[model samples]
Target: MKIGVLALQGAVAEHIRMLGLAGAEGVVIKRTEQLEELDGLIIPGGESTTIGKLMRTYGFIEAIREFSARRKPVFGTCAGMILVAKELSGQEEAHLGLMDIRVARNAFGRQRESFETDLAVKGMENTVRAVFIRAPLIESVGGNVDVLSVYQDQIVAARQEHLLAASFHPELTDDYGFHSYFLDMVRQYR
Candidate 1:
């Protein structure tokens, strides 16, 4: 199946590479019109505010909401998680607000504090390597949200129906477990 990575910003190439490893065609989505051609979409990590601003400027906010309403799978990493959240701690505005979650932006501290870890994600047979860079933390989740993986007792990965979110960058690592899992999600939805 074809999976589209939101190309407004962030690690587009890395995610595309991961998607390739996961056995799916990865397409870069620069315009809202491109959303219609994908089976699933991945929103990669970047500066949350800047991504949100760009989404608004490009008229993607409502388009993405519509996309999610169709029950297609959506995966968000780091800043992308913040964008998908229904509420952002300390911030009055929400971006896409498609996932029923609340997040705290850069809760892992600055870039210098970034680190890597192996996480035993739910539904995975092996631990997955994750890279956290200025990551956000899931403060809370709605009843529909399923906790996937946690680190240091903090919510770092979760899934809500067609929506999947992670506080770390799975694409940055060599592991294809997360991408494979996302591909499964897409397959189920397709």
Candidate 2:
């Protein structure tokens, strides 16, 4: 399986490494044209506003929407989760607006307040280590969305069909379980 990590910004190499450990060929994707040959794409953690701007400027906004429209798997981590949500708490618009979720930007507070924890993800038997850095919170999810994992009674991970979202940076940990879970999604839809 060929999984591409959005290389506009943020832990691009880390995500690629995770994907490799998950048994998939990882590709660094900068151009929107790279979406074609990928079985799935991971939008890594970064500043949400900047990622939104870059996606628009690079023509990925529509390209990605189209890609998801075809049932292609998309995984969004941290700020990437904000980009994929349908609604932003105080904002009037969304970046990708692909997932049926409402998100709170920087809900975990500032960078200084960043923390790590083990979460009971829905499918996995073992707890997954999650690192939260100025992460977004999935305040609510529509009927189509499934709450995958929660931390302190708050939603931190979710999935809506082929779209997987995480409020924490899964790439920051040594565990490849989350990435493998995403690869399973890709395999199902591939």
Candidate 3:
């Protein structure tokens, strides 16, 4: 299976490497036209506002909405989770708004507060290592959204149909469980 990583900004190479471990071909998607050729997409962790602005500048916002409307899987990590949320705490606008969730940006404090931990993600046999770097917190979820995992009582991982979101960077760790789970989502959609 081929998966495209939104290469607008963030840890593009790290995500690609994780996808490789998950047994999928990971392609960097720099243009909206590239969205048509993927089974799934990964929006990696980065600066949320900057990523949103760049996506808008490059005309990727609508293109991605159309892509997700096709029922293909879309996985968002950290800043990506913020982008996929329908609403962001203390903010008026949302980026993609593909998932039915509300997020709080930088909820885990600043960059120096970033840390790592293991999480028990649903449908996985083992705990997945998670890296939080200025990650956003999923403050609330819609009825359709399934809570996957939580860290310190905070909603961190969730899935809404074909969309999967995580407040931590799974790609930063060596474990490929999250990526594999996402591939399974793509397979089911296909």
The sequence of per-residue lDDT tens digits that candidate 2 reaches over residues 88-124 is: 9999998999999999999999999999988899999
What TM-score would every model get versus the actual structure? 0.99, 0.99, 0.99
Question: lDDT per model, in order?
Answer: 0.95, 0.95, 0.95
lDDT of candidate model 2 versus the reference: 0.95
For model 1, state the Cα shift of residue 107 in Å: 0.7
lDDT measured at residue 148 in model 2 versus the true structure, 0 to 100: 96
Error in Å for residue 164 of model 3: 0.3
Clash totals, every prediction: 0, 0, 0
Q: What is the C-alpha RMSD of each candidate to the true structure, in Å?
A: 0.6, 0.5, 0.6
Segments of candidate 2 deviating more than 4 angstroms: none
| Alpha carbon RMSD to native, model 3 | 0.6
In model 2, pairs of residues that clash are: none
Worst 10-residue lDDT window, candidate 2: 15-24
For residues 1-190, could you state the per-residue lDDT of candidate 3 as single tens digits?
9999999899999999999998999999999999999999999999988999999999999999999999989999999999999999998989998999999999999999999999998899999999999889999999999999999999999999999999999999999999999999999999
What does candidate 1's lDDT look like per residue over 1-190, in tens digits? 9899999899999999999999999999999999999999999999989999999999999999999999999999999999999999988989999999999988999999999999999999999999999999998999999999999999999999999999999999899899999999988888
